[model samples]
Target: MYINSSETAIIALLEKIKSLEEPDSAGIFYNAFIVILDAFVQPFSITILVSLVVLLVLLFFSAMVSGSEIGFFSLGPQHLEKLKQSTSGRGKLILKLLERPKRLLATILIANNFVNVAIVILSTFIASQWFNLSSFPVLAFIVQVVVITALILLLGEILPKMYASVYPVRFSKSMAGVLNVLIKMFYPLSSILVRSTSFLDNRVARKSHVLSRSELSD
Candidate 1:
């Protein structure tokens, strides 16, 4: 009876091992684990998270810079004097920077363009990293444009400008140093843009200044 009972226990252990090694049983267990992991784990990695945060920060600053243009230029003579008298270093700095309109315009334009380019590149990287965007070629391009454009248009351009218009003096004062540094950084490019715009303006003025032939209309 003891020998018979020992044999029965050994047979049960062998049967358990065979069941575990069966193809259908192993496949079911493997697939179930995969499903559980998929359900619980988020796909984003640290680098992806960092990139998104940086992208948002860049967009916010870009919008502010774009709005500063309107805010700085729109100040009337009376408001300008008030800013000049104010003790805030930023207010004084704003007046000084505004003295050279061409330089200011060029700097703002260059900086804004740089920020926008960065936004586009970063956005593309995110889309590729997160969504494997290249797989859907047309959709990738469209998604990139629509997402970036909406952010830039709504946050970077329209809202900032509207806010600046409402508080031009305050906005200019706050952004004075930032604009100054950006201007200095891109001075060469800013000067070139100023020269080109001046040339274009003079050319148009000369054409418009020319008189029609007396024989025809004069």
Candidate 2:
């Protein structure tokens, strides 16, 4: 067996590369294990605790904004009459908000989306602090999809909307002040969205009318 100098050099290089990779691979596994261990053992930090509190607060606001959508929009003839007769400031605000339905809907949607995004970001931050979510795909999916979605659906969407629908007038009045401020604050965004939707509606109506006329002629 005759081996050349180049072959010897290649073998040495391969050996060195394998030696380097072995430690790196071990280090990665070791670090991941340590992270999993600490997730169970360590107490949450003050920052994490505070973020969790903020997350809960955001969820509360999410519930309020989501409820307001049903509350204001579900107001019936009777509900309007109540607001019309009431001397309360909130009733006045509710009436004012309803005066512009498109803008009101836009504001509610924008606020809901903004709060939901904040909830996700804060939740991710808290989870990352506690565990290496990237290392556990199943757990990550459960937390991000199942747990978070359930929380939003149950607390932020379903329950509030149910309550609002059942007591539209009361819910509308209770949420009116906050929504009044939000409508002003989000006016620019809501206005743009309202205009865009109106334009789309007009275009769709014209297209439908043209189709109907064509069908009649045929």
Candidate 3:
């Protein structure tokens, strides 16, 4: 019953992921992942309908996150060079964000993943029941995976990324404030992710994944 609720499902997944690093936990975690998806059908109810709406809203935000990263970070050497010459506040803010590439990367990663996971969980509840695909487990899983993948890639990733690439400055400016707020709001999760990745990268490469200022400028 709890698994049918979107909020519960997201929390469950987050809790599950937190254990992924533990020894011999992969099988347990994977089993829980498959077991979380269950029916969430109702004859008619405003409350139930609202949950589905929330998922759609999350999908939209996920798309924005995908696009914002491209728009914000796709600035080239020449673009950064020109921005450095400008004295505008927005340019200064952009430069400031670029200066902390790890935080920027971590913030986008956190927001994107958080939204995307919620979308998947919500979709699992609605898709299986709405389409009556529960009768065929293999087919249902395939269909759900395919549909979600297509929607996320087309609407949430490809379209937005293309638009961001085309109008980087406009999109980046529009997204800057929202991203700044998200970075702070999700800082706890972002910070942990950044730190863990840095630790692993240093072990593997003898350096962190974080880019240097000169590297960013180049």
Candidate 4:
């Protein structure tokens, strides 16, 4: 009786191993896992790339505005040096530029509009001949424009600006070197642009004042 029972247990163990070794079942499970992995990974990869691109574009604009405004303010060397030492100093510089929030916002809006329009025109021309759909392509293009614009404004502009505002000092300090290099490189052109703008504004104001004076006299 004991030998019979031992043989029965061995037979059950062998059957379990055989079932696990079956090629069809194992292959099906393996393929299912692969499909699941691909489904999960592909969208995530695209999302990450898109986010990174948007963030970089926003940062570039933020840096440009920060550099130009910091140039305009003309802080003393001592304060500037101290700012360079602080944490998030680069972000801080950006926030400081936002002191005139309206102007900074206007600059960003104008820059975004210019870039998006150029991109749309180029994309439309390139895609026009590829697709034969009458109105679908145009509708798709409009949708793409809206989605990209919203993504840029939200992920690129609002989020980064908010984060920089929260930790300006640290951000500015961290990016100080990079910002300094960029500012220096673009200084000549930025100077020319800023000065020209100021000159034009002053002229307009003067003309407005002169017209008001003449009207008052009459």
- Which candidate should be chosen as best, given TM-score against the real structure? 2
Off by over 4 Å in 2: 1-41
Candidate 2 RMSD computed on C-alpha atoms after optimal superposition onto the true structure: 10.4
**TM-score of every candidate relative to the true structure:** 0.76, 0.79, 0.66, 0.42
Candidate 1: tens digits of C-alpha lDDT, residues 1-218: 45443344345545545566555766656655554334333388998999999999999999889999999999999898898778988888988998898899889989999999999999888877776443346777777889778888999999999999999998887789899898889988998999999999999877766643443565
Residue 34 C-alpha lDDT in model 4: 52
Rank ordering of all candidates by lDDT, starting from the highest: 2, 1, 3, 4
* Candidate 3 lDDT score relative to the true structure: 0.77
| Pairwise lDDT winner, candidates 2 and 3 | 2
As for candidate 3, its clashing pairs are none
Which pairs clash inside model 2?
none
Instruction: Tell me the number of clashing residue pairs for each predicted model.
Output: 0, 0, 0, 15
Q: Per-model C-alpha lDDT, please?
A: 0.81, 0.83, 0.77, 0.51
- Candidate 1 lDDT at 205 equals 79
In TM-score terms, candidate 2 sits at 0.79
**How would you encode candidate 2's per-residue C-alpha lDDT over 1-218 as one tens digit per residue?**
98643345446545555566455766656554654464432467998889989999999999999998998999889889988999998898888888999989999999999999999888877877765556457888788778888998899999999999998888888889898899899999999999999999999999999999999999
**Model 4 agreement with the true structure over 1-218: per-residue lDDT tens digits:** 44443344445544545566555766656655654343222333554555456545654564444433333334445555566566754645654653643344345345445555554454443333332223355665664576556655565456655665655445444544554555455555556656677789899999999999999999
